[model samples]
Target: MSNITVCSHPIIQQKISSLRSTSNTARDVRELVDSITRLMLHTVTADLELTPTAQEQTSPVAAYTGLEISTKLALIPILRSGLAMLNAASDLLHTAEIRHLGLFREETTLQPVEYYNKLPRTCSVDQCLVLDPMIATGGTAEAAIQILQHWGVKRIKFVAICVSRRGIDVLAAKYPDVEFFVGVIDEVLDRRGFVSPGIGDCGDRLNNTA
Candidate 1:
């Protein structure tokens, strides 16, 4: 729990509330998700290594140093629904590289199954952010963190629009160093392994498969 930070910014809170509405259309849900993701990235990455970068430039009036971000950043968005956050995050951190991971859950076992993995053989980011719309069981998150670790990433953070307390505990017990930036924490999972009081199947809604 020490590593978890639930954003309380008013705009983030409002968008999250709108995002979870069952009556929301596909476009509305995607827009809300992207909006919250951008806001969350801004709020959470405020303290990232600035590096105090400056480049000398000749201005019309005088010579001055222009500032820039030198920290190496990467994003790993867990497939389909997670892809919704990728563009927003990219817009926030324009220099950050992106990687994709695909995992689907087994309805019967209620566990994650990795169907696609395209992580680079070597990653050189100072920090990596993993994006997922919902974390219900944490199995998918566990896999993502372990993969990043195996690739020699030093710092990793998991960001989600909604998380279940059970899922948070599961990830906390295993990877205390990995931070979590979440919009809201729902209580528990429903009978079907989905988070209770959650916006129904984010992937389905976003892709209009429902």
Candidate 2:
């Protein structure tokens, strides 16, 4: 079964609420997204394995044992909305590689169209975290995941600010082995394939184009 973690952190909830408001400026949206991504990542990476250092580390005044992340990680942010969360994810996972996957939804079909890919020919990381602000119809997310899977990624976790029920259901059913960490799940998707009460074209909002 797919593991879905809906963030319940008070700060995350408040930020999501702020994001949903129509009055927020593009700056407000970007700041809020940065904050939310940092907070949510704490929960998303909590279970990552750690390994003790080969030798004790010396502090300013004393020596102490230290541990480091044992698993290698890669951040795959689906552009251009996914780029909004990239800095926050990078700040948290300082050593992780950053890759970009560009996908867009066709207006008529609501299917994903890929125009850019930066993944290596062979997988180099132990786990991959896909970043996208919203998952409405799930087409884009599914397409991004397919690319990663095809590149030989064995573990993938999707991180999103919000998701629609239809989106999550589609992804969960199709990629049961993958995990999801999202701020909230809205129950509706309008006929136009937009999540009801969602942040509304996060790419446009982030770029102040909407």
Candidate 3:
């Protein structure tokens, strides 16, 4: 089962289209990426658990629900490009706790391993959102989810700007309960481990690298 949810908003699609073009300047590309991330976050955080709080107003009393509880959701960024999307997801789910995990693609086999890990100590988390800009071969994502599972996270969701079919398949096969939220699903990975038709290197695009 391919459990990926691709955002279909016109604004998101338009901004992503701009990101796809090679002619876009670094500034424009960065801004488009930020815009697309914000939109994607809106869709991803729609059903977030919230706790109701009442406040007195001069006219009438009203209540609003803030993100239910601290342990309700955890945001884990897979480092580098994932850090870009992590900021947007954090902006949307302000109350959601953040756990930083740094994973890198090995030069030889592209397998992911932990360079840094700071998962939360609490084990009552209801859901966790993993942020990675590109899921080319599923190596990093699989390892990240596996780590989360070890830490007692029951529900997991992955958010990425683009993903390859093979990557999605690999993840689903490893962890069927995890859901993926992507902006676009692209073609195969190139020989260099980059997604074809992908927005160059997402980290480089966001950071204006050469």
Candidate 4:
């Protein structure tokens, strides 16, 4: 398994830094997160395969062709805060299918339990990317990937705004074949399973708390 590649772009770092500031208002943070998510999507999807298609002009003298994605792609958001990132990914990948999975951490146990799940009728897509803002304990992400794999998603990508080292390590050991992309890899997970230095509870920040 490969390590989660933390985006090192200067612009991404600037936006992330803004998002992390305690002084940032909820609205500001929300916008920053969305922007960062869109930028991150670009980096993550850079390697996607595309097929060329020819275009005919009115003059019929000039040949023009554009590339279209070769493989089907799906985006599965793990719920609440994950839904926050979902919107950005959808805006960027307008043609990609969207799936939803609800997994919330049990406050006391820090274990994730699913409250809802809705997937596309088929998962034979060439690539399916799981979108979630945070991956701290790995429970939610692990469970999410299990569901996708069961649906026959052969190639999977995990995208998150931030991840705790322990969480990344756990996912690598458990799902070695899947690829992970993260904006930042935090130094540690706190006792409550929250990533230290992470932008507080993402769902809370997004006003999606239950």
Tens-place lDDT digits, model 1, residues 28-104:
98899999999999867887766534567778999877667777988899998999999999998889999888888
Reference-based lDDT, each prediction: 0.87, 0.93, 0.80, 0.83
lDDT of 3 at 178: 91
Which residue pairs clash within candidate 4? none
Instruction: Looking at model 2, report the run of 10 residues with the lowest lDDT sum.
Output: 1-10
lDDT order of candidates, top first: 2, 1, 4, 3
- Model 1: CA > 4 A from native: 52-54, 58-62
lDDT of 3 by residue, 1-210 (tens): 666788988888888788889887777766776678889887777776555445432435654443243347788888777777766777777877888898998868888878999875756668989888788888898889889989998899998887887887777777778988889888788887888788787777767784
What shift in Å separates residue 53 of candidate 1 from its native position after superposition?
4.7
**Candidate achieving higher lDDT, 2 or 3:** 2
lDDT of 2 at 25: 93
> What is the C-alpha lDDT profile of model 4 across 89-192, one tens digit per residue?
88878888888899999999988899998876676578888988888999999998888888998989999888898899889888888889888888979898
Model 2 C-alpha lDDT per residue in residues 27-73, reported as the tens digit of each score? 99999999999999999999899999999999999999999988899
TM-score of 4: 0.92
lDDT score, candidate 2, position 201: 92
Candidates 3 and 4, the one with greater TM-score: 4
lDDT of 2: 0.93
- Best candidate (score: TM-score): 2
lDDT over C-alpha atoms for residue 2 of model 3:
62
Tell me how many clashing residue pairs each candidate has: 0, 0, 1, 0
lDDT of candidate model 1 versus the reference: 0.87
Give the lDDT of residue 152 in candidate 2.
94
